[model samples]
Target: MMKVEPASPQYFRSSSYSSCHDLFYEPDCPKKAKGPMLCVKQPSCSESNFDCSSIFHLQEAQDPSPSMSFKQAVVLVVAVEKLKKQVQTPIHFISDEDLYDLFLNIFEPEPIECETVELLDQPEKRYIYRNQTIEYSIRDIDKKCFLLQKPLGSPRLTAVHLQGPDAKKEVKINMAFYMCPGNPTQEAVVLGIAGENLYLCCTGESPPVLTLETVDKNVLGSMSSSELQPFIFFKSNSGSTCRFESATFPSWYISTSLAENERVKVSQLGQTAFTEFNTSRS
Candidate 1:
């Protein structure tokens, strides 16, 4: 049975409030030795059916013995219900897109595997040696072009006779060769303007005219499809000279014109075709 002990001079100064310091027992009470207990209460329900559970109390625990009072049972029940509600609360999860974004923020994307090489553009300096016994030293010669621009500031690859002082200046005449990695034959490669993202491509037209396309060299290794074939060339070398044939059009090869200062174009490989170029790496 629980009884309300009126506030006394020992527990509290006022008689209106009741205290559980002398009424209740708590083994882990922090303020047991203190002057007065912090847990004070006002009479709410009748003494016959007291509802002390409605009011907040500190260190209000049952006795160490097996026996429990009505007040102690009510306090334990309320604490258990509050804990259950907290555990039963619904949890929210992130969407697929949001999860992917979070993953990207945490980890960096892997870089594409590709290679870059230099192609010296001196068409007249080419020497065709068809000797079979002299194994070809020029390998993986992807028919790449340098930063060749017209006077009008348009990006175009033109095979012109540049030598001596003009050829020495790398900025004026050069080609970037991109060889496909892991290929046993080393036939696959890309042609681009030296030191630029611009690549030379052909769309397999009746008379294929070279088109300039912008492609990030960093992503070149990941390209594998019909769309990428236009930019890919099959490299074949003889002595110091090499020829780049279009992967899209088997018969077509990248060729220069007989006349000087002519735009680079693709032509069907023939006896008279100017397809072979002298390759040298700087």
Candidate 2:
């Protein structure tokens, strides 16, 4: 037997360095040419009872799963406690597959809730309560009436006489107020020429122009509330009269010219233009 000596005291300057013996190599031990590895002499197979060819196998066999690891033991203990609590009757035993599933479930991410998924996929509920087909006549403060005129084969609004010879005929062709859906306050409305497919549209120019553009009422059935915003007007009632301001163009109201028989248009100034109109259901 060879004895190994401790390293020089110069190697340990502070008390932080503890003394430890190198078991792999000794200064006076004989080393085999096995690259940079330190070699140690082994006893014969007969004396040590170790087959050199199967040493690793024998070592593994000696410690073949003597006990479960910390994590495995913890999972087993938890699984047993959960089983004891859940089972109405005494648990006879638990299968290996059940334990594996429980172990996987402990670490696996939970599935998304059904209610949350349904909310994400469900279509938004629309609240459209003003009744779609209600018609009304828009009469200006000056007693001038709003009547549709198609002189150049294009339908446009014109302020006309209320009690003239053609008064009854013009009043019969009153404007229809299609209240826009999804507006809780009932302020937004779509003005369409009664018995015609023409709707009042605001042009997207520098200064928006009001024009009676032809729209398919059938196609409007398929449109969303946001898509109908161009033709929608915000109706604000004051006393006996109400103002129809353009929804697309804020602060702009539907107005007519000062002179009678002139085309009804849009104006930003309430003082200069005739904006207030008294409505009557037809």
**Index of the highest-TM-score prediction:** 2
Model 1 lDDT, full chain set: 0.54
Q: Which stretches in model 1 have alpha-carbon errors above 4 Å?
A: 1-147, 151-153, 169-186
Question: In model 1, how many backbone clashes occur?
Answer: 3
RMSD of 1: 19.8
**Residue 226 in model 2: shift from native, Å?**
3.4
Range of the 10 consecutive residues with the lowest summed lDDT in candidate 2: 51-60
Candidate 2 lDDT (Cα, 0 to 1): 0.60
- List the candidates' TM-scores in order: 0.42, 0.50
Q: What is candidate 2's lDDT per residue for 1-282, written digit by digit as tens?
A: 111112222211111211121211223222222223311113332433211221110011233434535554354344334333433356578899989999898888678866533355634324242554567777788878877778889777889876757776563232334554445565666777777888888767668899988879777656675567677787888999988888778888899777888888888864587998888887
Once superposed on the true structure, which residue ranges of model 2 sit more than 4 Å away at CA? 1-130, 171-183
Please report, as a residue range, the 10-residue window in candidate 1 with the lowest summed lDDT. Answer: 125-134
| lDDT against the true structure, each candidate | 0.54, 0.60
